[model samples]
Target: WDAAYERELQTFEDIGDTGEIWFGEESMVRIIRWLERHKVPLDSSVLDIGTGNGVLLVELAKSGYMNLTGIDYSPSAIQLSERVREKEGMSNIKLKVEDFLAPSAELSGFDICIDKGTLDAISLDPDDAVGKRKQYVRSLSSVLKPEGFFLITSCNWTKEELLSEFGEGFEILEELPTPKFCFGGRIGNSVTALVFQRKKAKPSILDKLD
Candidate 1:
């Protein structure tokens, strides 16, 4: 991402023909519609995990969301996000340089969290990929408010894989439809978009006694 931003590219596709944003504007439209359908308030606090260029944050701001925060582990990514935010005249959106896998008290209490391709990138790490993925889930669970909404978009994992990954702390709210292709007379989607609600913690025996 640092290398990508150094080239002054606006979107992920601008860096190369990666076609990560192949869903195009329809992705953003679906996200907004889902939030509205769930009755998420316009003033709800939103955190965009691994917000590469902060494009999603800018779009949410334009759609009337008031409190928006974007974070990226790469310094260059945050710098690019800042530039984009400024260019769009969205000074109120917060951009931070922070690793999502690392624990941070300041990153907590978000009403909504969105992840786009971040988990897929993390899963590619050569060093302790399983440990890192677990850490990612823990960090995300800590930051999001109880019963908050978490929307994730991925091109790598199948719906079943994603459900297994997040099953412990979240429950499925909805699965948004994505473009499908027929392969060998079977239909499959290239992308998976899911909305999950954080599960409220159950009281321990000691707490129940109180």
Candidate 2:
């Protein structure tokens, strides 16, 4: 993916900040508007996993979201994201080079976790995709505050699949609308947006035993 991004950046340096905003601008707008409609606090602490060039973080910052952090596995991606941050004059945002599937100790207790096409990229890996995705979910759950929001945008999975994957650990809050483009009467959007809240910890039977 990094190599592909490098090639893409070479071709579209004028257009792309770092060749990672594959979801397009329309989807970004829709998700941001949906968050506003749902009354997500602008001051909420946010973590954008697989942040790419940090386009999502930039958009959130432009929308007045203060506590912003972005993480990417690729060092080059983080470098480009940092460039974007500097160019945009956004000082409050933090950019880190880290793997979301195994995040660092410093990433924890965030009020909102945003996964925009990150899981889709993981699913594209043919080797152990299911196991890896499960690991990703576990790692994400670890960093989020109890009952914090997990907003995900994916083109690879439907709303049903997302809910199924996260239902064990979260409560489904809502499914945001996706723009439809029809081909041969098959009606569906290329992407899906799902909002979920991390489930609060349940009391264990061992508590009574203790």
Candidate 3:
């Protein structure tokens, strides 16, 4: 991508309401709770696609996970993540500025894939919606090992919307919504969290081409 095009990606610099932005949303907390309940091995490798601000990955680090890799497209975000990692003295989590649809060689062979609002944002773009979803899903399928988990958290989409897009190829372990908070009698689902296990083994290059 050109410099002009790269400038358009939403980064931490572009984020408004700095005061409102926080890592510990209720849904994310719930996600952590669920993960704790499931309790995968500590040795498992994790991939964080579109890891915004690197907050979720940092949370994973705090949980004692060693093999965490993050990929995001924004250069500014990448720089910010590196700084945070360095400042936090984090040695295990590797962050890369990369398009989600384009898998870096370093990205493959992960046991867990976590996406926080990445696929939801891509689906909102009308022009590239279909193609982007397809490519992203394909790359995810390629990178994830069999029996891997793809955990997604989204505020914009309901559980049904996610199921509609990606039900057939994987098994949905959980489909739950964030708790509703009522102020003046208007309450809505604040977020939807879903985790799916990749059933098929990562396809070979020949399998992918065919």
**Candidate of highest lDDT:** 1
User: Ten-residue segment with the worst summed lDDT in candidate 1?
Assistant: 13-22
Please provide TM-scores, in order, for all candidate models, with all chains considered together: 0.92, 0.90, 0.79
Considering every candidate listed, which one attains the maximal TM-score? 1
**Per-residue accuracy of model 3 over 6-88 as CA lDDT, tens digit each:** 34333334752111123246645665667787887777898888765666777778887888888888776666666557656
Ranking 1 against 2 by lDDT, winner: 1
In candidate 3, position 200 carries an lDDT of 76
Summarize candidate 1's per-residue lDDT along 1-210 as a digit string, tens digits. Answer: 677655544553254321234247677788998988878899999999988778888889998999999998988788777877877899999999999999578999999999988999899999999999999989989999999999999998999999999999999998999999999999999999999999999889999899
Candidate 2 yields a Cα-based lDDT of 0.85
TM-score of 1: 0.92
Q: lDDT (CA) for every model shown?
A: 0.86, 0.85, 0.74
Question: Which segments of model 1 are wrong by more than 4 Å?
Answer: 9-23
Q: Please write out the lDDT profile of model 2 over residues 1-210, one tens digit for every residue.
A: 677655644544566445557578876787689778879899889999888878888899999899999998988677777777887899899999888888888899999998888899899889999999999989988999999988899999998888889978899988888788999989988889888999998879998688
How close to the true structure is residue 122 of candidate 1, measured as C-alpha lDDT?
Answer: 94
Q: Which regions in candidate 2 have their CA more than 4 angstroms from the true location? A: 7-20, 206-210
Poorest 10 consecutive residues by lDDT, candidate 2: 8-17
User: Ranking under lDDT, best-scoring first?
Assistant: 1, 2, 3
Better of 2 and 3 by TM-score: 2
The total number of steric clashes, by the backbone 3 Å criterion, in model 3 comes to: 0
TM-score (C-alpha) between model 2 and the true structure: 0.90
Using TM-score as the measure, what is the rank order of every candidate, best first?
1, 2, 3
Cα displacement (Å) at residue 75, model 2:
0.4
